[model samples]
Target: MSYCEDTIKKMLPKAYVRKHVAHEIYVAATHFKNLVPMMDKYVYNDGTTKDLMSLTGTIPVLFNDKTYNIPICLWIEESYPQTAPICYIRPTREMMIVRGKFISSNGEVEMPYLEEWKNGECDLVTLLQVMAVMFGDFPPVCIQPHSEPEQASCWLQFQRQAEVLSKTDGSFYVSLLREDDQPFQQDNETSC
Candidate 1:
C-alpha cells in the first residue's frame, strides 16, 4: 500500500458505499504517474473547511503538436463516487490562469463531464482523461511574461493610471490598460 492508500484508509474509515475510493485513486496514480495523492484541508466558498483527499500534479496535454504538462488538483469529497470531485487548475509560478469557457478566473474547472457526473459511471481516471481532452482544446493557463525591473515599474504606472481612469468612468481605458499593460501608442486625437 502506498502512502495515499494508507492515508485514505486511515482518514475514511466509515467505509462508504463506494468502499473502493482508495483503489480508484491507486488506479489513477498508475495511469498518471506524475499525480501524487495527499490529504489536505480544503476550504469551501462559504468559508467552511474540510480535510479531504486530494491528488495534485500535472497531466500531459498535447496541444499544437507539442505536449505540455498542465498542473491540476482534484479534491475528492468523503462521499466518493456519489459526488464529483472538485477540480482546479493549479498553475505554476511562471504560469497565469486564463479564464476560459471551462475554467474560471480563480482556476476552478467547470465542464460537462463534471456537471453530468453519474455515480457509477464517473471515475477519477475518466475524469482526468476528459480534462486532458478539454484542456487540449482550450488551455486553462498560459506562460506569463517575465517582468524586468523596468517592466515592473511600467506595469505599476499602468495600474495607477487604470485606477484613476476607472474612478473617472473611463471604462474602456480601464479594460484596455488592465488587460496586459502593454504600452499603447497615444493618438493626438484620442483623449480620455
Candidate 2:
C-alpha cells in the first residue's frame, strides 16, 4: 500500500463504511499526485472542532492557453461519502482569492455538484474534475500584482502606515514606495 493509502486507513479507521472513504481518498491521491493527504483539525462555524482528514495541494486550471495550479484544501468529515467534503481555496501570500459565482469571498467553494452531493454517486475524483472545469470557466483566484519581494515589503509597509493614519486621522493618503524611488499612488485622497 502507498503512503497515502496507509495514512487514510489510519486516519479514518471507523469500520466498513469508512473503507469506501479510504478507497475514494486513495483514488483521488493517485489522480492528483500533488495533493497530499493528512489529518487536521476542522473548525465549524458553530465553534465546534473535529479532527478530520484533509487533502491539501493544487488543482490545474487551464485558462486562456496557460495552466495555473490553484491551491485548495478539501476537508473530509467523519461522515464523508454520506456528506460532501468542505472545500476551500487556500491562496498563497503571492495570490489573492477572487470571489466569484463558484467561490465565496473567504475562499469557500459552493457549486451545484457539492450542493447536490449524493452518496455512492459522488466521489472525490469527480468532484475535483468538476472543480477544475468550473475554475477554468471562472477562476477563483488571481496572482497578486506585488509578487516581487521588495514590492511586497513596500506594500506591507504602506498598509501599516495607512492603518495608523486611519486610526489617528480621519483622512489619509497612501502610496507604495518602489525601488526605483517612484511613488505608486493607490489613491489621490482617501477618507477612512
Clashing pairs in 2: none
What residue runs in model 2 are displaced by over 4 Å at the alpha carbon? 1-4, 13-16, 147-192
Per-residue error at 44 for model 2, in Å?
0.9
lDDT of each residue in 126-163, candidate 1, tens digit only: 99999998876666765444453534432343344333
Model 2, span 153-176: residue lDDT tens:
423433442322232556432222
Q: lDDT, candidate 1, residue 71?
A: 89
* Local distance difference test values of all predictions, in order: 0.72, 0.71
Please report the candidate that would top TM-score against the real structure: 2
TM-score of each: 0.72, 0.73
For model 2, what is the alpha-carbon lDDT of residue 108?
99
Against the true structure, what is every candidate's RMSD?
Answer: 11.5, 11.7
